[model samples]
Target: MGSYGKLVRDQIPEIITAEGREPITYIASRDEYHRRLREKLTEEVAEFLSADDAAALGELADVLEVVHALAMSLGIDSVALEELRQAKERERGGFTRRIVWTGNR
Candidate 1:
């Protein structure tokens, strides 16, 4: 009977019901849904950062799922998102740099 007033994956309610538990839930308004999704992104990222390498992959998937939902919420598709990501990687490069700036260079 724990209460978690947070955004969850679409299948969560069904999973709860299948477990022989009644899941009390309601649809969020568009604005609220957007807000909750942002919160979920932050929450998932924190979880990923704290996980061990093996567990971090699963957490990373959760983070990507939130990213996909956020992109769709903003009317962008997966292909477009990936294109933007690639473009940015090409322009500014990604973590492959691993260049650590200590202090005043």
Candidate 2:
């Protein structure tokens, strides 16, 4: 037993069994899922920030997976989420301009 009390990928138990170790896991309730999803997103983001360029892509992928799960947990499909993102981007614009503001008027 690795003694992990954290959320893990769905296939993790199967993988553990294949490695000749038993993994104890249970499905999370909807409310608990929401809470854990928040934690997972923060974890993945921190990992992405701390990773080197070579490892960064993998970390980003993990972050994206967490994002997808979080969205789905909210009953938001990918298309609807993308639409919302685009709507916000169209209204407020994206970061492509690389603008910095220093104000003292």
Per-residue lDDT over 1-105 for candidate 2, one digit per residue giving the tens place of the 0 to 100 score: 112477888899999999999998888889988888889888889999999999999999999899989999999988888999999999999899998879878
lDDT of 1 by residue, 2-91 (tens): 135888889899999999999998998898888889999999999999999999999999999999999999999999999999999999
TM-score of each: 0.90, 0.89
After superposition, which runs of candidate 2 have C-alpha atoms over 4 Å from their true positions? Answer: 1-4
Worst 10 residues of 2 by lDDT: 1-10
Model 2 C-alpha RMSD to native: 2.7
Angstrom error at residue 28, model 2: 0.8
Global Cα lDDT for candidate 1: 0.91
Model 2 Cα shift for residue 103 (angstroms): 3.5
Clashes of each: 0, 0
For candidate 1, the C-alpha RMSD (Å) to the true structure equals 2.6
